[model samples]
Target: MNCEEATKLLDGYLDGELDPITSQQIEQHLRDCRT
Candidate 1:
C-alpha cells in the first residue's frame, strides 16, 4: 500500500466504503508511511 494506491483509496476510506482488509491496509500504510 504505497502512497499512490492509498491516495486513490482516500475518498473511499473517508466515506467508509472500503472493505475491512483494504481499510486495514490503508491504516497500516498510514502508520508506516513517513510522508
Candidate 2:
C-alpha cells in the first residue's frame, strides 16, 4: 500500500485494532518511512 493508506492504518495499529497482516504491513511502512 501507499503512504496514505499506511498512515490510515497506523492509528488502529497503535490501538491494537488491526489484524496481524495489516499490523505487520503498517509496521513495515513505519520502518521504511523512518529515515
Question: Taking the tens digit of each residue's C-alpha lDDT, what string does model 2 give over 1-35?
Answer: 66899878888989999999999888887778854
Off by over 4 Å in 2: none
Q: Could you tell me how far off, in angstroms, the CA of residue 17 lies in candidate 1 after the best superposition?
A: 0.3
lDDT against true structure, model 2? 0.84
Best by lDDT: 1
Best by TM-score: 1
lDDT of 1 by residue, 1-35 (tens): 99999999999999999999999999999999999
Candidate 2 weakest ten by summed lDDT: 26-35
TM-score of 2: 0.76
* Model 1 regions lying over 4 Å from their true place: none
Q: Candidate 2: how large is its RMSD?
A: 1.7
Candidates in order have lDDT scores of: 0.98, 0.84
